[model samples]
Target: MKKIVTLLCLGILLVNCSNNDDEMDIENSTEIVVDETQEMGTDMYVGNFVSLAHPTSGVVSVSDDMSRLDFKNFKTDNGPKLLVYLTTDTDATEYVNLGDLKGIEGDYNYTIPDGTDIGKYKLVNIWCVDFSVSFGYAELKK
Candidate 1:
C-alpha cells in the first residue's frame, strides 16, 4: 500500500509539472503582429494639410503652415520614411519627388520646410525600411 501511494503521488507531480511546461511553451510561442491590416475611412490634418479617403475638390493648397502628414493604424518596429511628391492634376501620371522625409513614428509629424512650394501635393508613399513595407498613394493636401 505504501508503494502504491508513493507512485500515485509521483504521477500527480509529473502531470502537474508537464502542465506547467506546456503553459510556458504556449506563452512563449504567441506573438503579436502589428500593422497587419490597413485601416481605411480615417482622415487627419496638420495645420493647413488634410488627408481624406479621396482627393478634395479644387487645388489643395499647402505651405509652411502645414506640419506633418498624419497616418492611421500605422505600426512599425522602428519608424517609417516618407516620400513627398507634387503633381499638377489627377490624370498626370508623373510625380516630382520633393525629398525623403524621415523620423516618422506612430502618430508623428514631419515638419514642412518654409520654402516648400504651395500647390497640390501628396504623401505619395511611406516606406518602412526596417519592416520592409510601404504605404502608397497616401494623398495629402499640402
Candidate 2:
C-alpha cells in the first residue's frame, strides 16, 4: 500500500510538471544590457554567492533600473545544462529564467526582461537544469 501511494504521488507530480519557459513572458533577445560602466550599477541591489552543491563564489547585483543582472568575480564549477534564475527563494519556487550561464568563471551580464517585477525575486540561483539542483545562490538585498 505504501509503495502504491508513493508511485501515485510521483505520477501526479509528473503530470503537473510544465516547462518554466511557458510561464515567462520574456523576450528572446540575447543582447547584453550592461551600460558603459561595465561595473555594478550605482543603485544596485546586491548579494554574495554561496556554495550549495558545488564550490561557487561571486557577487550578483541587480541594476537600479532592473534592466540587468551583473555577476562580478563569479566562479562556479562547470556542469551540463546550467542556467541562471532569479527566484523568490533559494529553492527556485516562483522564478524567472535568465537563460544559460555565459561562462563558468568571469564577470558577465544577463539582461532582464522588460516589465519584470524585480522586487518579487529574492535570490539568484546557478541552477543545473538537467539534475534539478542548485550549484549555488545569492540572496539579494538592498
* Best model number under TM-score: 2
Against the true structure, candidate 2 has what lDDT?
0.84
Model 2 Cα lDDT, one tens digit per residue, 16-62:
45435545334532323335354455746889999999999999988
Worst 10 residues of 2 by lDDT: 25-34
lDDT of 1 by residue, 1-142 (tens): 4566567777866765777453545433433333422322123322222333222121122223454344433332234454544434333244455456443333433455555443454544434334443433444541
Candidate 1, poorest ten consecutive residues by summed lDDT: 53-62
RMSD of each: 16.7, 20.2
lDDT for each candidate structure: 0.40, 0.84
Quantify how close model 1 is to the true structure by its C-alpha RMSD in Å.
16.7
Candidate 1 accuracy as TM-score: 0.30
**Prediction-by-prediction clash tally:** 1, 0
> What lDDT does candidate 2 reach at residue 52?
97
